[model samples]
Target chain A: MRDSLVAAAFELFLERGYEQTTVDDIVRTAGVGRRSFFRYFPSKEDVVFPDHEQSLADMTEFLAASADSDDPLVRVCEATRLVMRMYAANPTFSVQRYRLTREVTGLRTYELSVVWRYEKTLGDYLRTRYADRRDGTLRANVVAAAVVAAHNHTLRHWLRSGGEGDPLAEVDRALGFVRETLSPDAVPAGGGTAGEQEAEDVVVVITKRSTPMWRVVREVEASLGED
Target chain B: MRDSLVAAAFELFLERGYEQTTVDDIVRTAGVGRRSFFRYFPSKEDVVFPDHEQSLADMTEFLAASADSDDPLVRVCEATRLVMRMYAANPTFSVQRYRLTREVTGLRTYELSVVWRYEKTLGDYLRTRYADRRDGTLRANVVAAAVVAAHNHTLRHWLRSGGEGDPLAEVDRALGFVRETLSPDAVPAGGGTAGEQEAEDVVVVITKRSTPMWRVVREVEASLGED
Candidate 1:
């Protein structure tokens, strides 16, 4: 019944336009009573983001279950994948909703609120994991935002491509860039035990801007072998 | 006149609560006509975020003026500082709004929408700068989101402290971390000319996870001296 209502509402929205289409019109088109429509969705905006609440819950649960991981960032990335998959599960519905939301200012604002919730959830999970670290709260918020941004970047690309490509692969690649960039070891601070050791042996050799690559490589190899 | 209306609105909102406070009550409190109130603010919610629109405009102008810089990210960070200064300029008012928004879900959502516009502005600037680069769009979006997240993290910390202390310093530090972490050099891709030279000359040394840092450092010095 809920699916039928969503389908009917989408048809009405596309045909009659979002602002012009009323709940009465949607209920009439869906062949469902007003009470059923009210039970399923709170308002017209709610219908446009039908699966967001459920997806958010699933993401929270997924993160909660991975509380023991060594790297919370990895878990956050995985949780984001769950969201991507939810959209991928029904590309047609997702694409239609995306177009409608893009065209409506209110719906776009609503979508931002939904996206904020996801970022907040991811940040909350990371906060717990990095509670003892300095600037943990800030780190959690920044990393969560980066993950969401990367996911959205890939998701939008797929949507613009009519949802035909492998969005999961694109998202994974984007997430990989984020992880490599913002991971604890990548940024400067108290280099962990391993990081400190790596830092000690790694001689950061800076060459002239116009230095040739072959000479630099040969110089590095010779330096390493000299010991 | 606008400031007086905002002050009146805030007073009425505190007394009657956000949801219960009507536009009529605000006009009455300000001793202003309904037309004047409407001219200043479109809705009750707009009063809570009076400076955001102007702040966003300033940021856009700042970025637009720096379109030809070698590193657009530097300009983006500077633009964000303008927003920080705006809030810092009126600490008491900012703190009060922060508290009220925290207590009201609708205002909080509205605030998120405002923040999204800032992020979008930064992303739009970055997208143009990185247009010809690989994964440029994705990189632009992720970096912009990271910047906004970092700024918000610091801003919230200051607000939670009742708008006391040095928020600009804290924000600069946070932005510095982001600039270092997500900067073009931090992420992987085609190494620029100088980067390629540095990359070639830099022979990464990996000591065992448990290796003592002093020993690793001594070995590195010895190797360099041997050459």
Candidate 2:
């Protein structure tokens, strides 16, 4: 019945436009009463996105099942794959829905709320993992947002291309920024980490701009001597 | 007249509740007709966030004025301050609205759209700035989201605390993470970059993880010998 209702709703959304299609129109087209429609979906907007509730639960559980030893950043990155899988499960439906959402303002806002829920879930899990750190809450939130942003950008790129190719691979590359640049031992993109490194044995020498190479070598030797 | 409608709407929202309050009631309270209310705000949601349209324009203009040489990451971080300044401008009102949005699901979604717009603005500005790079669009969007996430986390902390203290200082500290960890020259936090020097000689040694300090020094000395 839920599937029928979603199908009926999408049919009407695609045919008559999302704004033009009413709940009564959807229920009537599905050959079900309005009460049955309400039983399945609280609002018309809810029908356009039937997979989020289950997907969110699945994502939350997946993160919960992760070990403490796993890198929280990587775990969160992996979790985004679950979302891609949900969309990939039915590329036809997902592509149609994506197109509908791009054209409909209400659906777009609804989509943002759904994405926010996923980000919040990731944030919550990371917060627990990084509880000991002083900026645990901040890092968790920022990383969660970054993961979602990357995931969405790549997912949208795929969707915009009519859902061709592997979204998972694209998403992995996108999420790598969160891991590579933001990781504790990150060697920043352009090399100099504006100023700090956490691990031992690695050395970053900071000098005034345009410093001579010979002087740079001297500085490295002097630092080595001190060590 | 616009100010009066906003004042009247917030007044009724606090007293009679947001859901229960209607457009008719707001117009009645403001001593104006419904048409006048719509003239100022397209919807009740617009009244709750009366400042965004103008604040966004100001932020866009600020970014538009940036020079080619300005660091784009830092520019985006600075752009977020305009948003913080908007919320900090009216602490009492901002705090009240924040409370109301937290309680109302509709308002929360509405707020999310508003936030999405700000993030989009930052992203658009960044996209133009980083257009020459291959991953420009991806970096632009991710950094924009990161800046907004950090800003909101700190802003909400202030709002949750009844909007007390210097939000600017708090936001600057929060935004520093984006600059420090994500910046091209950023030194990761902890030890290596902690001792930033103004010496004329600088070197960066990237080696295998867990490499011994002796090898790192030797490696540095070898590089100098080649030079």
Candidate 3:
């Protein structure tokens, strides 16, 4: 029934325009009463984004189920992938909604609010995970914003191409950046620069003068990771 | 005259609530004709955020003046500070607008669009600066969002505190994370762990046994820069 209403809403919205198409028109086309429409959707704007609430709920549940051992950065990347899947699940509807959203000022603002909710959810999960660090809250918020920005950049790229190609691959490449750059666990490979820290790293590899560079390189890595 | 229209609109919005107040009410309250009201602001929502247009223009101009020597990350932080200063310039008005925006969903969404413009401005600047990099667009968007998130987080903190405290200090503290973590020029100080690098940094010092440790450290630093 919800799907039917959404289909009807989009049909009327595309044909008669979003502002001109009333809830009454939607209910009439869907062959349902006003009560059914209200039961399913809170408002007209809600109909345009029928899947987000479920996707958001799924995201919250997914984040909530995260294990203590999980890397928060990787977990965030995984969580955002769920949103991409939701959009990918129904390309026709997703493309339609995206096009509709761009054309309407009110819907554009409404979409922003929805996007804000996703960022908040991501931020909340990360804040808890990073609670122990000195800049935990700030890092959580910045990383969350970064993840969203990366995801949206990729998603919009896909959408602009009319939802063609592998969005998952595109998004992964984008989120991979957040994990690589901002993840503390990923930092030691290069040191990790955000600002000032323990000064420049100084490693003294005391391999034999005849030792090959590769073996000396391996020894240096093993020693650095020990710290 | 423009200020008076905004002042009158806000006063009317506060007294009678945002939705109930009409443009006529604003014009009547300000003792200005309806034509004058339209000349200053296109709609009721515009009155709530009168300074953003000029501020945005200033921000764009500020960002456009970026030189090749400038660090894009730091430039973004400085650009966002302009917004912080604008809000700080008018405490009473800022507080009132913040409160009003919180109470009205419409205003909140409207504010989001204004924020989107700012983020876009920052992103466009960063994208151009990072155009030479592989993930230039992705990093630009991520850093842009991070800057705005940091700025908004600090601004809201100030607003929630009844607009007290040094907003500049709070924003700098927030944006400090972006500069520390995302800046490429800032990356060398930490070795940078974003991902796998040149295996590991192995610095071999073949100094005499009597050489000072500080001298060895300086030699290692000089060699590392050569890479």
DockQ of each: 0.34, 0.38, 0.31
Off by over 4 Å in 1: A190-227, B190-227
Cα miss at A177, model 1 (Å)?
1.7
Q: Candidate 2 on A1-227: residue-level lDDT in tens?
A: 99999999999999999999999999899999999999989999999999999999999999999998888888999899899988888989999999999999889999999999999999999999989876779888888888899999999999999999988888888887556556643433233423333335545554334445566556555554454
- List where candidate 2 sits over 4 angstroms from the true fold: A185-227, B185-204, B208-227
Tens digits of per-residue lDDT for model 3, A1-227: 99899999999998989999999999999999999999999999999999899999999999999999998988989999999999998887888888998999889989899899999999999999989986788778888999999999999988889989999998998887765556452222233321112223433333233344455445544544544
Best by TM-score: 2
Instruction: Please give the clash total of every predicted structure, in order.
Output: 0, 10, 7
Instruction: Please give, for residues B1-227, the per-residue lDDT of candidate 2 as tens digits.
Output: 89999899999999989999999999999999999999889998899999999999999999999999998988989999989998998999999999999999989999999899999999999999889876889888888888999999999899999988999998998887666657543333222422222212334454433445566556555544443
Clashing pairs in 1: none
**Tens-place lDDT digits, model 1, residues A20-92:** 9999999999998999998999988998888999999999888878847457988899999999999999999
RMSD of each: 6.4, 5.8, 7.1
lDDT of 3: 0.80
Residue A9, model 3, lDDT? 96
* Candidate number with greatest DockQ: 2
Candidate 1 structure lDDT: 0.79
True contacts kept of 3: 0.44
Worst 10 residues of 1 chain A by lDDT: A191-200
